[model samples]
Target: MGVRRVAKGVGDLLIETLGEAVAEVILNLVACALLGCLALIACLCWSFSPRLTIAGAGLFSCLLAHGAWHTVRNPPKGRRRGLAALTAVAFTSTAMTALFLLLYATGCDCL
Candidate 1:
């Protein structure tokens, strides 16, 4: 029947979409992990210099905030507000950390 054929087509399309989404998520996780490892190495090597260390942390915070903001902007399905709130928390924390580091690096004894 036409109804059966349409249902089968819809199912197939859903399966294909799910498969692609899963694959994309996996690929993104792998890439992020690799880049994170590289950043860790660079940070470790740069630890001998205070300025460089601060720079690295600041750069990392900026990147994290950017990513979080992007996620907030594009929000995922079925829990958009919750996800946006979580991302906002993440962005705020990163911003605070970066600000603290900057102040400390600049010789503030506010600790």
Candidate 2:
């Protein structure tokens, strides 16, 4: 009976840990998707004005570089590497979107 209880306890712990990990993953993915959308909107806004577009492009480039650095710095061991890449991409896209938005709001003509 004691052995059975111990086995059940271990199984419960494993299940809880797995659940937490899965929840974290889901949250990360959602955040990334939101960032992508923001970046896309900034890109669209850039089309209306060249100066703003240049600024937006700069932001996009920065994000790309950052993402590349992240991927290179953290070599993925297995399935987690893919997740890390996705996270980086999401972060970069969101940053670009934010930069473009700032440019538009600032009204700075010189890029």
User: lDDT values of the candidates?
Assistant: 0.66, 0.67
| Top model number, TM-score | 2
- lDDT computed for candidate 2: 0.67
Q: Once model 1 is optimally superposed onto the true structure by TM-score, how far is the C-alpha of residue 63 displaced, in angstroms?
A: 28
* Candidate 2 per-residue lDDT over residues 1-111, each given as its tens digit: 999999999999999999999976665555566556656887778767879878877876676776767755855565545645766876666667667555443433222
Number of the top lDDT candidate: 2
Candidate 2 off by > 4 Å: 49-111
TM-score of each: 0.40, 0.42
